[model samples]
Target: MNEPFAGAAEKPIPEIWYGIPHGYVQVDLDPPVEQIEELVQQVLALPDGLRAQAEPVVQFYAGFVTALNKQNARACLLGMHLDEYDEPATSVITFSTVPAHGTSAKAIIAGTAADTVDGSAHPLELPAGLAYFSEEERRTPAPGRPAEGSDGPLMGDIWQGTVAVTGSGGSEIVVIQLVTSAVEMAEDFRNILLGVAHTLSFSDPSLSGDEAGTGAREPEPDSVVAAVRSVFG
Candidate 1:
């Protein structure tokens, strides 16, 4: 006998992050947008009362990463709502794969360390088990910028960590960042994020129906300045 709704079922996957234990809140690195969209449409087709139940689903889709520099490159984003997350730092991490041109991970790491050292940056190493490069710097906000009704500028810290990994036929650079006005919390935030990065992993190259690889088509670049203005203006 043929099962009618078998195709619409969702499979459950274990929620383990390397060796770190995650409870209740499950994180999905990159979710299948197509299936989410299909479910959204199905919910929309439902009559009134039942539609409200789909609101959370709609919100979840809103947080989906619609595009990035690499069309098929994998990205991990942690969406924090200002009202709910209440953290002083705004962090962003991006991973992109491109032609290696015979570049080795060791060379990339060395180059990163040298470049930062020239810029007066304090070099930092990846955790005991991870292999990546990182650096930190203090950033003082413009003196005239309005902040907390204060006449003086606000000081903060900015950290960036980068690592290169070999992929199918190219190399991938994983960049982790942390920007915060919370000077007292800066170091803690950096360590926390770096710890999360230590567990980073990737999947094997995959081919779609017509595409050669996942993220094969690049997305149009979006300007951060323009995006901020569009949202706040």
Candidate 2:
């Protein structure tokens, strides 16, 4: 049987479009074993001694996709960023839609913000219609300076940014979620997300790939994916 998000078929109707910068790569839950091997060895640049660890890593992301798909996700992308020291190398962004049916975009946005605990949403100025940005933190680590008790927490913190907007046709609500464990770099993540959010547009659902001169800046570039493609192929 085909696994969840394993090369999901393209939807034929008009869909939402946005920018993905150079550091991100789209995820595919299922791909050939050979490609997976190449992903560990090449894209990730993992050493041969750690070769056996790739399977578990793949399985973790498969579960991640499965969770999103269960909630009506439309697309998933993984970001592997490396600084001068390659710190905080992973982040994830997911695009999903909630059936608006007949609900007003204001109600949807307000209700979402209200439901969140300690949720704060602010007006987002964008080309897209009626958008709000909300941030939520789950299982935050112990409150203290980073250098002290850094390893005390059994689990790392989870940070997420939810960007909700009215669908192009008012029939659905587009939700773009950005998540990462690097809570310390929240400001950087927020800036990156805004760059992407500004580019949002509703377009053909079956829009195969990034088209030239469409004013759609790719969030992830083709060259960035050549290696990432193997990881999530």
Candidate 3:
């Protein structure tokens, strides 16, 4: 249970967090937790020019954490940028969980797949009774002021997955998200996302003490490169 994120607990703020039931899972990304917090603090301390660009992302992280807390996620891995920025940026892998009251894994898969004509959904073949995958493109026009690079709209891709596992005396849906800025990088991002999700293992910490289980974990050397390449490449 706590063994997985033990390093997080060692930090002053702790990068890894476990939920009350400890039914969900977590995977460490680059920069960890303390670095992300420190990055945020540095951005906040900046004067006006660069701070304006980074503020939205800082706010977004705050709001996202709030949302996950409200959803009663038992454990999660926080991912974010460690460097300064002038505009809003997205996290690489955001994990969270919510109660699925009788929601069939098939229903979740179908609904997620139906969101895009080009996207496909398939079973994860893991311990979890149900798992789903979906990939899609997103577009955002320049609002008021354009983002750093382009003169027009911005395009990005999102890879999402869900695993339904019952443990900790209840059932929960594990949500995985990989967001990047392009269509060409979809496949790469999807592979990395699946790697993380495939490693997910659920257990009832209340019943099993400190030992939680694991799934078919994939060894990804340089996860940071995988994440960045998915967007920049």
- Best-performing candidate as measured by lDDT: 2
Instruction: Residues 131-183, candidate 2: write the lDDT tens digits.
Output: 78988778865433466656565556877988888777766777888988777
Identify the runs in model 3 with alpha carbons over 4 angstroms from their true place: 1-91, 103-119, 141-144, 147-170, 204-233
lDDT of candidate model 2 versus the reference: 0.64
Go through the candidates in order and give each one's C-alpha lDDT.
0.41, 0.64, 0.46
Ranking 1 against 3 by lDDT, winner: 3
Give the TM-score comparing model 1 with the true structure, all chains together: 0.43
Worst lDDT run of 10 residues, candidate 2, spans 1-10
Per-residue lDDT, model 3, residue 198, is 44
TM-score of each: 0.43, 0.64, 0.48
lDDT of model 1 at position 105: 47
**Candidate 2 lDDT score at position 190:** 78
lDDT (Cα, tens digit) per residue for candidate 3, span 1-233: 21322122332211222221112234432336787789888998999988998898777666666665575433445333222334433334555555557775456554665564565555555443456666656554422554798666654444343433332223445565655543354565466566555444443212233222453333244232232233233
The reply for model 1, stretches above 4 Å from the true place, is 1-30, 42-64, 69-73, 77-99, 117-132, 135-184, 200-233
Error of 3 at 154 (Å): 6.1
Model 1: how far residue 140 lies from native, Å: 14
Q: What order do candidates take by lDDT, descending?
A: 2, 3, 1
